[model samples]
Target: MNHPNMKKDQPVTLQTFKKGDKYHHKIVVEEAGYINDVIFRLGRETPGSYNGQQITVNYEEQGGALVGTVKYPAHNKVIHNTYEMDGQNLAKTSECEGVVHKRWYNKQQN
Candidate 1:
């Protein structure tokens, strides 16, 4: 998925870190001409574990202006997910269950 304001084929980086007994993963995307970046973090759990998993995502505009964070819970296994500009929710579909979607743009400012 792509944000309207974000350029096509923008640079994205994924990194993993260990804190305490849990593992954390972070995915970051940098927007051209913007000081702020989009960040996504997975809950402290081993990979391939989706049950009860939580994902925290946030996007910030240039110059530290606008920022918003949204959280999604995986009651079931998530199969497909996408994010787009002007969209406030995480478009997700579960494997066992039906579609599960939630927006995380409550802290955004126009």
Candidate 2:
């Protein structure tokens, strides 16, 4: 999620904070209105920029977490992700290449 006022071409840094570093984080979806579901991916680059990257997904409920697989045929690489909501936050564990990446996202309050 990003600030709605931010332009698509705006530069943004996506990094994890160090264990001892203090930081504030939130994923905001402002004026989202009504939707049937919320599905997204987290990466250094937008998912659309990946050539030959095929994505398949399904969800168990409306506006709920998703389970999906992202495959990069060009590199023979694949990432599998399973998502769930923990309390008010979003949590996911991704198996990419040979590494496991765990991510959590806090929902922003209005």
* C-alpha lDDT score of every prediction, in listed order: 0.38, 0.47
Per-residue CA lDDT of model 1 for 22-101, tens digit only, reads 43444455563333222333332223322234544433333322233344455433343333334543222222246455
Candidate 2 accuracy as lDDT: 0.47
Provide the lowest-lDDT 10-residue window in model 2: 21-30
Candidate 1: stretches off by over 4 Å: 32-77, 80-110
Best by lDDT: 2
lDDT for predicted candidate 1 compared with the true structure: 0.38
Mark the regions of model 2 whose C-alpha exceeds 4 Å error after superposition.
1-48, 51-64
Q: Score every model by TM-score.
A: 0.31, 0.45
Reference-based lDDT, residue 97, model 2: 67
